[model samples]
Target: MRKLTLLIPILVIALIGVLSSVFVVDEREKALVLQFGQIKAVKEDPGLSFKIPLIQEVVKYDDRILSLDTETIEVTPSDDRRLVVDAFTRYRISDVVQFRQAVGVGGVRVAEDRLGSILNSQIREVLGADQVTSDTILSEDRRELMNRIRNQARDSARSLGIEVVDVRLKQTNLPEQNLNATFARMRAEREREAADEIARGNEAAQRVRALADRTVVETMSEAEREAQVIRGEADAKRNGIFAEAFGADPEFFAFYRSLQAYEKALQGSNSSMVMTPDSEFFDYLKSDRAAK
Candidate 1:
C-alpha cells in the first residue's frame, strides 16, 4: 500500500508537468515560445504545442487585424491654415518573432504606441507638404493622401513587424479661436455684399425717378403749348367774325361797340361816367334822346 501511494504521488507530479508543458493556441492567436527570455519557436497555426515546463514560457498575440487610434494632432497646410487632425490605423503583427524582439514583454500596447508615433509623423509630413492645402485635405484627394501616409507608415513599421493595412484621417477641424474669426469675416463679407446691393438699388431708383420727372415736364410743356395754340386760333376766329360784322354795317357795329363800352363802364351800381356830348361813346345815347 505504501509503494502504491508513492507511485500515485509520482503520477500526479508527472500529470502536472505534462499539463504545464503543453499549450494550445487558438486560430485567432500567434504565439512565441520564450526560453529564458530568448525566443525558441513561433507557433502560427492553431493546435497543441510542446515546451519545457517551468523553463520555457509562451507569449500569445492576436493575429487578427487591430486598430490604433492616434491622439489629435495639429497640422498646417501649404495655405497656412492650421487644422486639428484625428487619425487611426489598421494593422497586424506579420512577424511574431520580430514583434516579440522589438517590443519585448510590453506586448501589443507598446507596439501600438510606437506605431502611433510613426503614423502621426507621416500624417504631418504628407498633409503639411507644399502641394497640400486645407481644400485638398477636405476633398476627394484626401483618400490619396491617406494612402500615402499609410505607405510611409508601413515602411517605418517594418522594423517592428507590423503590417499597416490602412491609415485614415477620421476628422479635421479648425481651432475654436480660428472658427470664430472666420465667422466674423464671413459676416463682414455678407454685410458688404448687402450694402453693395442696396447702393445699386438706390442708383436704379434715382435713375427711374429722373426719367419720370423728365417725362412729366415734357408732358406739361406739350399740354401748355397745345393750349396756347388753341387760344390763338380762338382769338383769330373771334376777330374774323368781328371784322365781318363791321364790314356789314359800320354804324350798327359802332353802336353795338358803344353799348358794350357802356355796359363795361357801368358794370356796378352807383357808377357814373363823365364824357363830352359829342364823344362817339355818347352818340347812341344822344341819338336815342333826340329820337324820343
Candidate 2:
C-alpha cells in the first residue's frame, strides 16, 4: 500500500510537468519561446507547442493589425501658426524576435509608449518643415504630409520590430487661446463683406432711381411741349373765326364783344369799377340798341 502511495505521487508530478511543458498558441497570436531570458524559438502557427518546464516561457504578441491613438500634441507650421494635433496609427508586429529583443520583458505596453513617441516626433518634423504651411496641413495636401509621417515612422519603428501600415491625422485644430481670436477675425471678415454688398446694392438702387427721375422729367417735358403746340393751334383757329365773323358783320361783332367785356368786368356780386362817366366804357352801357 505504501509503494502504491509513492507511485501515485510520482504520477501526479509527471502530470504537472506535462501540463507545464504544453502550451497553446492562438491563430491570432505570434509567440516567442524564451529560455533563460533568451529567444529560443518562434511559434507563429496555431495549436499546441512544447517548452521546457520551469526554465522556458512563451511571450505572445498579436499578429493582426492594432490601433493606437497618439497623445494630443502642439505643433507649429512654417507660417508659425500653432496647431493642436492628434493622430492614430495602424501597425503590426513584423518580427517577434526583434520585438522581444527591443522590448525585453516590457511587452506591448512599453512598445506602444515608444511607438507613440516616434509618431509624435515624425508628425512634428513633417508638419513643421519650411515648405509646409498651416494652409497645406489643413487642406487636401495634408494627405501627402500624413504619408510622409508614416514613411518616417515606419523607418524608425523597424528597430522596434514594428510595421506601420497607416498613419492618419484624427483631429487638427487651433489652440484654445487662438479659437476666440480666429472666430472674431472670421466674423469681422464676414461683416465687411456684407457691408460691401450693401454699398453695391445701394449704388445700383440709386442708379435705378436716377434713371426713373430722368425718364419722368423727359416724359413731362415732352407732354408740356405737345400741349403748348396744341394750344397755339387752337388759339390761331379761334382768331381766324373771329376775323371771319367781324368781316361778315362789323356792327354785330362789336356789339357782341362789348357785351362779353361787360359780363367779365361785373361778374361777382357787389363788384364795382372806378371809371369816368364820359369814359368810352360807358359807350356800351349807354347804347339803348345794345339792350335789343
Candidate 3:
C-alpha cells in the first residue's frame, strides 16, 4: 500500500504536466510554438496540440484575410486640385516567420500600419499622374486609375510579409473651400461657350441673308431685262404692221381714222356748235354730206 501511494503521487505529477502541456488550435487561428523566445515550429492545421511543459510557449495568429479602412486622406493633384479620398485594403499574412520577426503578436495592425504608408505614397503617385479636378472620381476610368494605385501599393507591401487581396476607394470629394470655386469656374466656362455659339449663329445668319439678297437682286434684274426685250419686240412688230397698212392706202386710211374720231367725239356731246362750217374738223361731215 505504501508503494501504491508513492506511485499515485508520481502519476498525479505526470497528469499535471500533461494538463499544462496540452493546447488546442481553433479554426480561425494558426499556432506558433516558441521556445526561449525563438520560433520552434508552426502549426497551421486545426486540432489538439502539445508543447514542452513550462519551457515552451504557444502563440496564436489569425490566418484570415483582414480588412483595413483608412481614414479620408486629403491630397492634391498635379493640376492644383484638392481632394479627399477614403480607401480600404484587404490583406493577409504571407510570411508568418517574417511577420513574427518584424512585429510581435500584433497580427493585422502591423501590416495595416505599413500598408497605410504604402497607400499614401501610391495614392499621391497615381492621382498626381492623373488630371482630376476638385469635383470627384465618378467614372469607371477613375476607379480603374485608383485600382492601379492600389496595385502599386500592393507591390510595395509585399516586402512587409503581407499580400493585398483587394483595394477600393470608398469615397472621393473636394475640400470645402474649393467646391464653390470649381463650380463657378465650370459655370463660367459653359456660359462663355454658349455666348460663343450665339455669336457664331449670328454670323451664319448674316451670311445667309447676304446670299439671299444677292440671289434675289440677280433674279429680278434678269426678269426685268427679259421683260424689256419682249416689250421692245412687241413695239417693233406693231410699228411694222401699222406702217404697212398705212402705206397700202393713204387717203382711205386717213378718212377712216377721221370718221372714227368724229364718231367717238359726237357720241358724248348733248349740244354742238358749228364754227363757220368750214372748219377742218368738218371735213368728215362735209365729205359725208357730199357722199349722201
- Top-lDDT structure, candidate number: 2
Clashes of each: 0, 0, 0
Give the TM-score (vs. native) of candidate 1.
0.75
TM-score of each: 0.75, 0.95, 0.67
Model 2 agreement with the true structure over 1-292: per-residue lDDT tens digits: 9999999999999999999999999999999899899889999999999999999998899999999999999999999989999999999999999988899889899999999999999999999999899999999999999999999999999999999999999999999999999999999999999999999999999999999999999999999999999999999999899999999999888978988888888887899799877777757667575575
Cα-lDDT of candidate 1: 0.93
Inter-residue clash pairs, candidate 3 = none
Full candidate order by lDDT, most accurate first: 2, 1, 3
Model 2: residue 3 alpha-carbon error in angstroms? 2.7
Q: Where does candidate 2 clash, by residue pair?
A: none
Q: Candidate 1, residues 142-233: lDDT per residue as tens digits?
A: 99999999999999999999999999899999887798998999999999999999999999999999999999999999999999999999
Runs of candidate 2 exceeding 4 Å displacement: none
Please list the C-alpha lDDT of all candidates, in the order they appear.
Answer: 0.93, 0.95, 0.81
Task: Report residue 286 deviation for candidate 3 (angstroms).
Answer: 8.4
